[model samples]
Target: MNRLDIIQALMGQKNLKNYLEIGVENGHIFFRIKSTFKIAVDPKFIFDATRRFGKSIINPYNLNNQYFEKTSDDFFAQDAQRVFSAKKLQLALIDGMHEYQFALRDVENVLDYMDDNGVIIMHDCNPQTAGAAGCFNDWEVGEWNGDVWRTIIHLRSQRPDLNVFVLDFDQGLGIITKNKPESTLLFSPEQIKELTYNELVQNREQWLNLKSADYFYNYFDLQRP
Candidate 1:
């Protein structure tokens, strides 16, 4: 399943209302989400603002979307309180910088504002190749997953309070929620960074709690479409 399908299913199952999306590049996934209130954060958006507003005015589903043209950090630091004052954050998507530190901070920061039982979906946790998982200096024009998988490892190791796992699809769609984790790792941050892609591949399923696509469908009791 794709991010949108997972998101919409979770929204339906949880009766979620408020939505937050970080790293909204083209509004490809952001605008399509159905929520009572929605927030989008990105330093540089590829979509036209006027078109977004027009779509908002035209469709009830697209309405109430707030866009912040700033880093996720700045959005949380400056504008989070004002918006969250009225609505409790229910679900969020973290697809920003695609690096470990940024992705980790985005999760932590957004968690503070999330309602009970809230969920956060993180993108790029599963880089298909070692080249895709390369660090920023090695960044290329296409298919750079960065080290976001390390964030998952970090959370899985240190934060037992959160349930963390990667659904083995769509470049490793990560699901994070407030619950007891099914598995835990013993790696320190330094050890995680020191880990090689080959090492990760060796213990991929255990390290990431990697579940098959069938697992997701079964977990949610949703049919394949």
Candidate 2:
């Protein structure tokens, strides 16, 4: 399944109201979401802003579309409370920096502000090629997954109590929930940083929790009250 499919499936199962998306490149996924109160955070949003989603969906607080043209860190530091405004953050998508620490921090930040039943979707957890899963900031544009997968490994290792799994589709979409927030960091960010694409390839069996897309739906269904 693609990212849209996964999101659509989850949307079907949950009544999402407030949504936050980081890294809205062209508003492909950003505008598609029908959440009542929506926040899109991107350092640079490259979509045609005039274009509309063609739906008159109402939000909890009647707020209009909120877009922050800043990094996720800055967006959270300055506007997180304003964005949620005492309303629980129900859904958040982290498709930001694509780096391990950045992704990890994004997850952490979302968890800190999320509702008890909130869900976080992280993109690029499964890289199909070394070219796409590189550790370097400078990568050849062909399908770069960056080091986001490391964030999954780090989360699994550090927060085993959290409900986390990686969908084996759309280059590895990760679902994280079951709030067990903590102040722990990976023992050594450098150790995870030092890992190369080759090392990841060699250690994939040990680091990734690869799961079928159906598994996610089934798991979510079971979690439903």
Candidate 3:
């Protein structure tokens, strides 16, 4: 499915109120949600006016959204729990730091703030297709490896009670619901192990070649400018 379809599904969900987005390169998706309050987190300091397309002048008028310029990990570690307590998040989208560990942390942080019935939409699960091209159609600014997939695989094993659906199309979106899901759809430990193993084998070469170690070593050296 496309972004529009994702938005429609979110809109159709019952009792949705506040929304949170981990990576807001611009306010494109933020503006689409029409929520009373939107909290967008990104480390990038410069908000590209071009993201507003040719309608740049009209964009600043949108004041319902608030932007927090900080790395996703830092933002969550410092303030996520507090924010969640203040506003029970109805919807959350995680599109930041697509490394396996980072993605896993992002999910954990979002869940900390999400209401029991709330749903989360994870982006960039299809690394071979749409995400490979480095742009996620009209909704994203750049691409990263499908680390969220690895996280999902881990969560499937670690949290058997959570509802996880790997949507088949549009860059392989993953929908996770906190609501008590039907037991029939849940995955077994063996199945989770198999899936995770397969993914590791399939991406072993790329995984080994990743600059994750160096990235983290000099992480603070790199600032969003």
Candidate 4:
């Protein structure tokens, strides 16, 4: 599905109250989501302030909207605990850093704030492919390095309890649901090392076609296990 369709589906959900977006370039997604409270973080506040990137036209009417001038890593490492202490986040979108370590850290930090049934949507989980090459045009301004994809893989290995699904469309969006706490048995230490190493060597095209929802459902039936 496209971004609009995904946004519509999320808006239709009744449980969403608080929403957080890690990368708010122009508030496109922020403006789309209807929620009681919404928070957007980005270190390039000056850039956004200038509205040079064509994000200035976004309506400035949402009372619950809040924009923070902070890097994703800084927000995750220091501010997330305090910000989430009083609020129950029902939805979060991680489109900030596309690097492997940064994406992994973003997920680790946001998981603490997510409600039991809350869902986290990640952008650019699938790498660029010949057929899907044009999809990356929507990305803000950096090169796609498949960091988000690697992060999702690491999360699946480290946290077996999450109901993780990769949306094959829209430049590869990843949906991960937190259910319960459990032992980390899916990924071993050796596996993590191997995967990380392999990620560095894997071509973008290969990464983009690694697996899709159908593949997971037919092969692993991850939802059941």
The candidate scoring highest on lDDT is 1
Q: Compose the digit string of candidate 4's lDDT tens values, residues 102-125.
A: 777787778878888777878877
Ranking by lDDT: 1, 2, 4, 3
Global CA lDDT computed for model 1: 0.89
Collision pairs in model 1: none
The residue-by-residue lDDT of candidate 1 on 7-30, one tens digit each, is 888788767768999999988888
Which of candidates 2 and 4 is the stronger one according to TM-score?
A: 2
| Whole-model lDDT per candidate | 0.89, 0.77, 0.60, 0.63
Q: In terms of TM-score, which candidate is stronger, 1 or 2?
A: 1
Q: Give the total clashing residue pairs for model 2.
A: 2
Descending-TM-score candidate ranking: 1, 2, 4, 3
Give model 4 RMSD, 1 decimal: 6.9
**Which regions of candidate 2 deviate over 4 angstroms?**
52-63, 179-188, 222-225
TM per candidate comes to: 0.94, 0.85, 0.68, 0.70
Model 4 residue 156 CA deviation (Å) reads: 1.5
Better of 1 and 3 by TM-score: 1
Q: Which digits, one per residue and each the tens of the lDDT, describe model 3 over residues 1-225?
A: 354456445555454668888877766666566666678898983455555444334554345666678998888778777766678888888877665567678888788777887778777654653334232233254545544556665665566567665554555566677644333224454654345434545753332222232332242233221
lDDT of 2 by residue, 66-95 (tens): 889999999889988777777878888899
Task: Supply the global lDDT for candidate 4.
Answer: 0.63
Residue 122 CA displacement from its true place in model 1, Å: 0.5
Model 3: lDDT equals 0.60
- Once fitted onto the true fold, the runs of candidate 4 whose alpha carbons sit more than 4 angstroms away are 46-61, 129-145, 180-225
TM-score (C-alpha, index-matched) for candidate 1? 0.94
Clashes of each: 0, 2, 0, 0
